[model samples]
Target: MVIPETFFAERTSLLKASEIRELLKWVAEGGIISFGGGMPSPATFPRQQIIEAITEGISEHGDKLLQYGTTQGLNELRSELKNFMEWRGINVSNVDDIVVLSGSQQGLDMFGKVFIDEGDVVLMELPAYLAAINAFKLYDPEFVGLKMDDDGIIMDSLESVLKELKSKHKKVKFLYTVPTCQNPTGVTLSVERRKRLLELASEYDFLIIEDDPYSLILYEPIDVAPLKSMDGEGRVTYLSTFSKILSPGLRLGWVLADARLIKKFVLAKQGMDLCTSPLLQYIAYVALKRKVIQENLSKIRGLYKTKRDKMLEALETYFPEGCKWTTPIGGLFIFAWVPERVNTKELIQDCIKKYGIAYVPGQSFFVDESGTNTMRLNFSYPAMDEIEEGIKRLGQAIKERL
Candidate 1:
């Protein structure tokens, strides 16, 4: 089954497996205490409701649900999603502006396919989502890592980078951001900073892709709105998912952009999968109609808040000196920085095989490959007791390495 190296495409070299995904397979085998994947807790899924929705949707629309659908997605789901976006203050004047994705992850890959030419500039946070980095790597863009503070991306650093890029006469294709409750770092952009980012995007004449999957899962009340909602120039493409709120199994997510861009997304998505499954789209349609997602948000917030607190408390009680982690008000990960002497990617193997613990090392998350001393831990997937024990084992492993 092995192919010769000569048979492979040049882009095949960009296809690296996700560290979280490979680690989750081990976690599924049930020996390790995993702080790896950014997975929603099973407790958050509306099991009974999902079962009912699936059954009912099939019963009522068996002819359509079982068949292939349009590439732009179901009229029902897009119509429902339009209202959903409006509720969140995202402007959508037409249902044609929405393009349902198989998942937001697919949107990332499509963005690269749709936008990037080789050597094009794409700005990303210093410690970004590993999957997005991987997805975009396929198109061979020069990923410039923007400096981020606790309150999301630094404006001064971004403006300076933009100015320099302009001086070089290089165009930035788009600045991909998870602005609210960013991945790995779990930082939220301030409202002021959001305005500034939009301002800079306008000034520099670059597009913005706002990958927003975690803004609604707040533990504390934050006033920050999604950048797309604030975008005045139609430059931001707003992408989000039902994975956090409803069910990841549905594989339902969506993108909201200008009608012109939606046309391109539809064309791009047509070749990708034809369409997101009509059956799953029907389930999402039903869930939204019944207000299942809205009702479940409060419960999810409370469950994850307790879990986040437990992990934070455990780190304080167990992790050694010269280690610190983020205190996220929302989102699944707590990014940690250990001693510079420790390369977290190297430390993780001993932690897994020897200490029965796993985490996503931060090096792959950094486009610049500078976060060798960092790691990302997820609290939402594991139980509180597992969080405590896993953090202890992880701390011991880091200490042994140190």
Candidate 2:
């Protein structure tokens, strides 16, 4: 018996399949060089360390590891996370303000569940993280896209948008930002802008959701700090994942927020998954306690930086003039804008079938559906040779279209 469309909730209609994930399916068939998903390099995974950590955790705390954990997560893991955040310059005075998540994706969903109401105004960068736009879209919020310069979100543009929304009597709930080494674009918000952002949040009375998964993966030293660290009013809700720094397969992430907000997130989380796996939490606890994650960062940064440089070189050598891309300080992606007449969405299938390469068309990343001439290329997952060849092929595809 087939279920009718009416059987599904109306909210389900808003859900769209991720282009990057769909591209992965094609890439799995072999032959295609994919610059689609923002996946960490498998070479960077601390396999030996993980094995040791898992063995030690089970031998010492098998009972706890195997059993169910609290909705707020394992206390040991939270304690470790508090220390980790402190090292990153985020002062967590209490572990109660931390809540472990399955991934940062979960934290995004939780934000939608707890805060978003029908038509609530949610601010996002013009070309934001596609996953985030998809996650928040489920809750039916009015997404206002903000402009950005090389330094990340433009303060003037944000202030103007805020004033316009205020004039229209819109209830501005919060601004969701990837802030450091932002996805798709790979631009970090500068320290000056970070301070101004917090000031604007205060002046306009809105919350800031700082999704900071790529801060630790920088290739060059930047003076920027996490927005959460500068947020003195407790208005910033920070979300980060072990996906980049450690392993995405473990699927461990955490939220650093006010205690009251953490309590609410805990309640929402209980209705979602009772708790993130105790086994996984314990593994992360071991990894953090042993400083495995810390020790592995230099290797990850060095390797990805090389890949990033290779991709940039290929883009320069192969990509036709009139095409432009961001020179990221550190991140897995490089977002490019082709000639105005080239709609990447329309060219993607041809690129895959003919060029034997895949990339996420940038349109989906734009909340306002405006980036038709753009594409986001992932440099972390593909090998050095693949990076060069893939950029070459992508260049040819764009050039032919031009």
Candidate 3:
């Protein structure tokens, strides 16, 4: 079957398979320890609690649960989300500002569809989420990568780029950031930088997409707030999910944006899925209403923190002198850098084939594709023992390569 590649759209050629998802398959086959994918531990799922919630939800609203829902999502779920976000210190002035998504990933796609014109400028962290790069790539955007330090996005670099864009008379569509417990790097944006980010967005008249899935998972008492919380101008489109707090299988997430954009999101999503599942929304609604998701946090936090600690300790003990990594106060990942002489992308196959450990090479996460010496490691899904052994094996692989 020699099917012509021309049969597919031109944009299809731009897409690449996710290494993390591919590595997950190897992890599933068994003994390999996976530091791939932002997957939560199965131990975090409240099976009995979820089962009870599902049973009760169906018993009460079986007909509705089985029926198609509005593209905007369940009203009760949005209502619950409002209160929930309030508890986390993010307050919305109007209920109309909320739109439920299948997951935060959908919000990313829809943002691309509605806002990105071909050649429109989009800003991203140096090493951003690959899935996001894939989603927005389909819309034909000119991506500009932002540099970062421990405080997250470097404001000087951001302003210099903004000035260059202004000189070129180009308007940046949005600056997408993970902010709290960022993916790949696991660095939380500092409070001052967050404030400066909002100020810069206003100064430049560009929107901000705050993709915050890990803020609530913070292990420390950091006072950093979601960019949306401090957004008085309503320039930030905040996206979050129950994937970390509850379960990914439920596939429920929501957006908090200006009503103007919410209207567009509803229209765009209507063509996409018509609606997110009523049944899945019901599951999240039940979890929120019953406080199961909230109550489960302490346990999820404790378990992941222990695993994160173990992995950090292993890195210190086993990794080579030039190796360095972030110590995340919270989040599923610990991003690391090996010596510049070692390319983690080239090293991964050997690590998996010989060392029985798997991780996502950091190159794909970079919009500019420059992170060959880096890799992203996950601590949430792997057991504590796996963390110790996997890191030890990874260390040896790097040492041997060196």
Candidate 4:
């Protein structure tokens, strides 16, 4: 008797698997130069210091680190993160309020677990971080896509959405934003827009989840404060990570929210992995103490800026005329737009099949129906030479289709 077995929660059915990661698996098989993933260049990693820290980490706290540690995370490490953010202008006086997660991605997942419920309305930027869409989808939250421009999420559209939601007798639970150096599109939120958003959040009485991992890696200094920093009543749940600047393998990130909300997040973390890796936490602590973090960050900013510049130049030179892309002030991605008739999903397939070049279609990043002609190109992993060659190959690929 063949009984069909269905083993899954209803939430799992709504979520789509990562398209870029799935594509990368096959792209890897081709041995073609790839730019589909947002991986940092290994050359910029502080391997020497990390090695020294790890060696010293185990030597100083072998038994304590290897074993399970506090659910809230290593207190000393959280304090360091607090101090770091304070320097950056996020005003957090108490370190106990922060909960260290495996990474910022995990922090997002936990936030969803705490806040999102079936049928609750959530506002997200159109063409946002695919992982955030997936994470929120797991809770079956009703998503509203806010339009985006060079200054970041469109204020008029945001107002319209809020008004519409209000008229319907529904209020949004939260508005998710990437603010500085957004995913897919590397547009930084302007100071004016930031204030406007905070005002909107205050008026509507909804939270703003500010995901800002790439803000610190900017090529030049930008005087924009995090949404959390401007938040008066603890309305912003801010999250950032060490994945881009230090190392992804560390899997270290922290979330800053009101102490009340953080309690629930801590409980969620308790069930997830008990705690983040104590060994890595120790290493981070030592690195922070030794001031290796600042040095490594400087190196990363310089190296990635060079890569980004090369890619931008290549795009200018090689891509067809009339094609448009944002000149990112910071971050690993550059979003390009072709004609509306061009289906980027199909283009991705064709490029991979014909030219052996890969990119993520921008459609997947948007919750509302938009961005069909858009694609996201990562400029972080490839070297200067690879950026030139890859962009040339991609340009050649696009021209062939044209």
Highest lDDT scorer:
2
Candidate 4 residues 151-247, lDDT tens each? Answer: 9998999999899999999979999999999997999999999999999998999999999999888997899988888888888989999889788
Candidate 3 residue pairs that clash: none
Q: In order, what lDDT does every prediction score?
A: 0.92, 0.93, 0.91, 0.87
**TM-score for every candidate vs. truth?**
0.99, 0.99, 0.98, 0.97
Worst 10 residues of 4 by lDDT: 3-12
lDDT (Cα, tens digit) per residue for candidate 1, span 1-402:
898899989999989888888998999999899999988999989989878978987898889989999998999999999998889888788998899999998899889988999999999999988899999999999999999989999999999999999999999999999998889899998999999999998899999999999999999998887788888889999999999999897898999888877888888999899999998898899889889999999999999999999999999998999999899999999999999999998898899899999999999999999999999999999999999999999988988987
lDDT of 2 by residue, 1-402 (tens): 899999999999999888888998987898889999988999999898888877887888899888888999999999999999999999998999999999989999999999999899999998999999999999999999999878999999999999999999886999999998899899999898999999999999999999999999999998988998888999999999999988999999999999889889999999999999998888788789988899999999999999999999999999999999999999899999999999999999899989999999999999989999999999999999999999998999998998
Estimate, for each residue in 1-402, the C-alpha lDDT of model 3 and write its tens digit: 888998989988878888988998998899899999889999999899788867877888989988998998898899999999898789877777899999899999999999999999999998898899989999989999999988899999999999999999999999999999999899999999999999999999999999999988978889887888899898989999999999998888999998889999999999999999988898888889989988999999999888888998999999999988998889899999999999888899898898899999999999998999999999999888888989899999999988
Give the runs in model 4 whose Cα sits over 4 Å from its true position: 1-5
Q: Which window of ten consecutive residues has the lowest lDDT sum in model 2?
A: 49-58
For each of the candidates, the C-alpha root-mean-square deviation to the true structure, in angstroms, is: 0.9, 0.8, 1.0, 1.5
The list of candidate 1 runs beyond 4 A from truth reads none
